[model samples]
Target: MSIRLGNSCVNCQKYEDHFCQLHETTVGTKHTCDSFDMRAAIKDDNNCTTCSRYMSATCPNPKKAAPHMLCNHWAPQEVA
Candidate 1:
């Protein structure tokens, strides 16, 4: 699977306060690398409970989420 820095990095475990713990440096939201791992997305001061892609604070497509950011692949969560 291909990963984009902007969408993927925001939810990565290494990302902290705009810095990457693994890389030991600050990175932009659009930055990417091979060490990306999907963590729960941030809330961005909004409610994701209504979003279709929101899965208990996780996004399945990108395998990530962010409080203030949404990926291009965002979809409405289906109602069962």
Candidate 2:
């Protein structure tokens, strides 16, 4: 998790709901910019370690996933 996280707000410490706490502006869950800082408390499925597939069973892909890895299959949970 040392590397920059996928340049995403959902994984940023500055993200507060739909707002960017750092920029003081609205943001999408997938929105990102130069200021993205990974959240320390992040345990969302965005990463392989927290992914349901990795937790419940082995990953189906040919390559193994790293802790901070993001894959094409990642789908954000719907906000309802």
Candidate 3:
């Protein structure tokens, strides 16, 4: 297998060496499988980093909310 990235083992949850831990078959980092489960480590879009209340005390929710956790407090981040 060659060192590769993108929608494949490098970004999948079951990636393990030259094979997928879920299917137990030899796979490459450039080839995605039907059972692909994206790794949680991949940065998500709906996050506190992009929220308008990211660093403000007015935000009612936790400061470090889950990557996809959003609430009524969500507002478009203001451009400086």
True-structure RMSD, every candidate: 11.5, 7.8, 11.0
> How far out, in Å, is residue 60 in model 1?
24
Q: Write the per-residue lDDT of candidate 1 for residues 1-80, one digit (tens) a residue.
A: 97443445666878877889998988876787899887664433343444666765356544456545566555445311
Looking at model 3, which ten-residue stretch has the lowest summed lDDT? 71-80
Question: What is candidate 2's local distance difference test score?
Answer: 0.66
- Residue-level lDDT tens digits of model 2 in 1-80: 35334767877888877899888999886699987787675544477665556544446652666778877654333321
- What is the Cα-based lDDT of residue 23 in candidate 1? 85
Task: Give the best candidate by lDDT.
Answer: 3
Could you tell which candidate, 2 or 3, scores higher by lDDT?
A: 3
Ranking by lDDT: 3, 2, 1
Model 1 TM-score, all chains together:
0.42
Q: Which has the better TM-score: candidate 1, or candidate 3?
A: 1
Provide the lDDT at 12 for model 3.
85
- TM-scores for candidates 1 onward, in order: 0.42, 0.46, 0.41
